[model samples]
Target: MIRRSRWVACAGPFLFPWGEAGSRRVYGLVASLAAAGYDVVVAGGGPEPLTTTALPGIDGPGSVSHIGLSEKPPPDAGPLASSIQTLLRWGQRTVRWLDAQPTRPSHVLVHGGQAQYMFHLQRWCRRNRVPLIVDVVDWFNGRHVRGGYLGPLHASMKLALHHYYPRCDGIIAISSYLENHYRRTDKPILRVPPTLDVKNLTVDARQTVDDSSPLRLVYAGNPHGNRKDLLGTVIEAVGHIQREGASVELRVYGPTLDDVRHLFDGRPLPDGVRCLGRLPQAQVAGALQEADFSVLVRRPERAADAGFSTKFCESLASGTPVIANLTSDMGRYLRPNLEGLVCRDHSLAEVTEAFRTAARLSGAQRSLMRQAARSQALESFDYRAYAEPLGSFFRNWD
Candidate 1:
């Protein structure tokens, strides 16, 4: 029998069963790798896990193991200091673990732009000759920095990232826009789409939504000021839709709902607008089942939005048509007329017209769109398809 000798270390923010963008992608990839028989270790966060409970039928000798922040740092440190210390500790632990292991990994996959982790992992891999693959799903310098104190931190991280990219064996970027954005690195950059967990899709047709209610338009995502402010235009557009007697309600779900809710500032909604705070990922599909469509209007303010939004795939998975304003790199992957509508500008008229067009589609037509959405998702966005290339890369890394 082949001894399970290959050990792969995958690290990211802690993600449970239900996860956000980074968490979802990292967890899905790690699970797949574990099932394929490579001993895998996942190290990340400990604070606000969406699902702290373990997932049934997923345990194994080499299944998901969360590395907690508390294991390294004093539990009471401020968030920023705590994160830095966590990185230092995580780096130290990972190096020690790698050094003491009986068999070294063929490859190491590092996610995100944690500078300390990247530098330490690369240095150790170089010394030990383990190929390191870095996935740049989002960029730090050009995109992630938002307004406020976080901006400077992000700027510093970007500098570190620029300095670290050349040291990796390979890089996996999620979008072509990002691939081209970092062309100066002169390293092999693989453009991969964000993976969709279609298994979570509970509804296949848009008709599952209650038609009696005003056209249910929903936006499920972070409500932070940088990306969340786009909801303002959504409200303005929904107001226009309501003026046309198209009963419309906006449902905002995700961690940043408070940011979005505060944007309202007691300004009366036209009528049906409601804000449902962060809902579990398991609950999103059922909610999407009850809604007519999903909305994401990213203001061109940060690079985070310039990349891709997880809600984009989630919207497609729910078989709900998406109405988006900013045309980021995602525009390259979306199918026209079959999946949903993409607006050139965030004009009230544009949103109103898009809704009218959606209202005109027959049930069968909507079902066709839903199927197309799923097909596109499975072919382009699912993680399963990516395993071969990624696995082959590691398998051949001698």
Candidate 2:
């Protein structure tokens, strides 16, 4: 049997663009392990093995080592091509790449979606007797979660995942909802919410902005599926605000804006509507600073219900107030009268009224609400709290 060591983590295809929360969380997890005196080796998919961390060529002040997987199939390749390539070439390349590493991990951390490729890695770790820890962020049946492509084969893949989960040393669920669902399997699982690096982030004073203006609203997230409904609500609400002769402006950031514009099909955004496209993470805080409130208007669905999006936490940390629709997990965390306003219905009038009320609040009043949002971020969603529990979860495998 292989002896235990103090290393953990397996880098997934989701490594680059470290600006995103999930990517950053993965890096943070490895970095935290390194800080705890564990030797960390992150094997991931990229153009090449990363010589530095995800700050685009620059490494952070962390002890973790990163290796990006270069030989994997390009992301844009269609299904059959990618599958053939992964099965024929990428798996061997990944194994060979891990073999070339100077050290192996005592505990392996594997994220979902990539579970199909993991059997090979699992078998390899079994031969080495390394303990495996799998983290599941979404329901295996929920293909729409995180924009996972769900073709006909998705069902079979999910079945494979169900079988795979029981063999792991431990499992991580990011929400109580997910934990409850997975409990049916009788596996050892932990529900740790998506956490933010709250120390590096601070609740900045709501910058001296034109509060007299109609509420400036910002929405950020992928623009697909039911996300379209949320965007439509924002647009209609902004129209109502304008009809009321208020100076409301709505700014959107994400890949879905272009598709939305196509849906508009040449109808111009009256005046205050702007599609900012997807901005870099560094610029998002500034964008948030400029806005009166952030928006997360997800529709009621299994996927949205089970997972809490990172956008919710980041907006709070940036000191931007949020205006979320009453659906999914919003009711659980955000009180309707406190923290921020929750539109309990899909009516455009209700959403517009909330925007108007946000506009009417005094600077101090809004600041208090923003503070409440930030406090929630620090106390519950901060990464530091999850680190010890998660680290111990891995360590117990010894």
Candidate 3:
């Protein structure tokens, strides 16, 4: 039986209902916490505060209270002056919100990005005897240039890594790479992937394939920052197979043909690849459901391993197997032939061979792969599956 627990307050990172990766990740996490029997109240950066909002993509099968941290602009202030004032306001408001809680939180999960947020939460947790867990999503150590406009922000984040995280009672990481990077002997850590709603990703398994039709492979992200997906290598491999008369078509999303050309430094996309303009999230789900496979190859690097891929998990959930190369902890889950083709490395030859195998999958084989993909998504990415694990992770502290 799941033991009912006190509240887990998530503070300052993703904007609830709609934010980027951080928002999406926190949604899955709090939902899992709720499933594990912890009452969760999440705060996001939004235009206004709400008592409750629709749980995005995953949750407690209902809404949760949300607090917005967007402060009124410091009018008549210069750039530096305005930033300082705005940040101060956000910090003050965050502490006030936390203090205003009906009861003190039993546990707190806060992203370690904003120092003002961290300092206040640390003080609060220390005072209340509540455990504070740092949500370690992205590491800024290697990704940035360290000399640009983001220099100070980057330094601040790095300082948090060396200072705040090590002092925290526990670490909740998004990948094995991050878990390992932030792991300490004194603290416990759990690695969770960016999760999705398995029901939304459900696609009817295809019973038959038209032999004459080209194999459809969807690449649904901007190529500008591939996180080492090796877009050039992926396109080249597909183009080579096309030149050999293989019947395969690549649909590129999130970038128009012109945008593609511009992003690729005036280079044209290979003949077999078609640039499909960006679509709404719901529309993208439809596109993923219709595809034979999704291309998710990434090179071995800190950027690739440090963060898990939300797109990859979504594809599997949509019953579209990924033509993936193991970079992060993907090797932990990807079952070759059962899920999708796996490349041994990022070389052109290896990628070409992976594509060649994908093109050769028979209709029945594709159907089985589709079923297996969804099954993996449910087992690996769904929040419900992690309830027990999350429960255990916290129970030890008590």
**Model 2 agreement with the true structure over 137-252: per-residue lDDT tens digits:** 65543445443555533653465456776677677776677678778877678776666566666445653444565677888777564443467767777777788777778888
Residue pairs with colliding backbones in model 2 are 44-69, 50-68
Model 1 RMSD in angstroms: 4.2
Between prediction 1 and prediction 3, the one with superior lDDT is 3
TM-score of structure candidate 1: 0.83
Cα deviation at 271, candidate 3, in Å, is: 2.6
Among these predictions, the greatest lDDT belongs to 3
- TM-score winner among the candidates? 3
The residue-level lDDT of candidate 3 at 58 comes to 47
Rank list by TM-score: 3, 2, 1
lDDT of 3 at 206: 69
lDDT of 3 by residue, 373-395 (tens): 88898888887787678878877
Worst 10 residues of 3 by lDDT: 55-64
lDDT of each: 0.63, 0.65, 0.73
Cα error, candidate 2, residue 114 (Å): 3.7
Weakest 10 consecutive residues, lDDT, candidate 2?
A: 53-62
